[model samples]
Target: MIVETSPENFQVWVHSSRALSLEEKRMWLERMRSDPAAHPKNRWGRCPGFRNTKEKHRSPTGRFPLARLIWIDWDSQADIPLLVPESKPSLLSHPSRRGSVCHPADPCRYHFKKDNESTTDFAYALSLARRGFSDDQIRQRILSERTDWSNHKGEKESKTTSIAPSVVSNR
Candidate 1:
């Protein structure tokens, strides 16, 4: 099922054969490019008739965008087993051992570099900012997706805020 919470923004839900664990759900959310901070089981989807109250989503005519159902498939089921990650990602990190997961023509360069995660996170945040993501969106992505940022609350907030100046100057 897919719900449009605002223009060009959607939340997707998959009905699977078995219930997924918290970590499993997190992985699925990451794969779907969802805000990981909102991936908790207790998180509720926008109600169909409610307005998306975010200031940026407000229409020019002084109204907010309405959240609505985009699509649904009650009869369809997600393949649960395919969603699970391999037990050892390091085995696949090496280019030769990547098999078919990481295409030979286009390999994922960010695969197993835990030591440089902070640098990578900063670069990722910069990319998002360059692509016109709002400050809040960049903050959420940094907090949720960056391993280094998650461990340092004060530092994370400040770092996200600092991205705005760089974004403006670069443009």
Candidate 2:
């Protein structure tokens, strides 16, 4: 479903974007204001007709909206709302799909502990969470994934049974 519309709107956007330069944006804004459909929006991504390209907003290039053009200020170094826009790549990038079937939930620890892991490792978990899966549901989803754990070892050398511990400890 590759849809190509007027590049005119995109051109105006490219010109006025803060991601480029104030002088350039000003030049474009002034030049395009006269056009009837020159509204600061375009058909891109799952959304369309956005005035800005913030993660919450859409741009002429869809998810690849120019990083600088998003509504946030570059000086502030704000984070764009996380939106991968598509489910296929999202699902395909899962750790399980990549042959690592497990999302290790230690004896008991916060999931963020695995933040340093590959993005693929967190893909499924993140997907579940984003789709409104509860914390327990997300954990269950991870545990349900199949992975070859033959090469790895747990923290304890002793052969102990796996148990789901409450996240909050009494200590």
Model 1: lDDT equals 0.66
lDDT of 1 by residue, 74-140 (tens): 9988778756566865654344321234323421225323456666666555555554556777677
TM-scores, one per candidate: 0.46, 0.21
lDDT of each: 0.66, 0.35
Q: List the residue pairs that clash in candidate 1.
A: none
RMSD over all Cα atoms, model 2? 19.2
Residue 106 deviation, candidate 2, in Å?
26
lDDT of 2 at 52: 40
Please give, for residues 4-88, the per-residue lDDT of candidate 2 as tens digits: 1222233312212225333433345455564444433442332233334345545545753332322323244323223322243
Error of 1 at 117 (Å): 27
Model 2 lDDT vs. the true structure? 0.35
Best by lDDT: 1
Name the runs in model 2 displaced over 4 angstroms: 1-118, 151-171
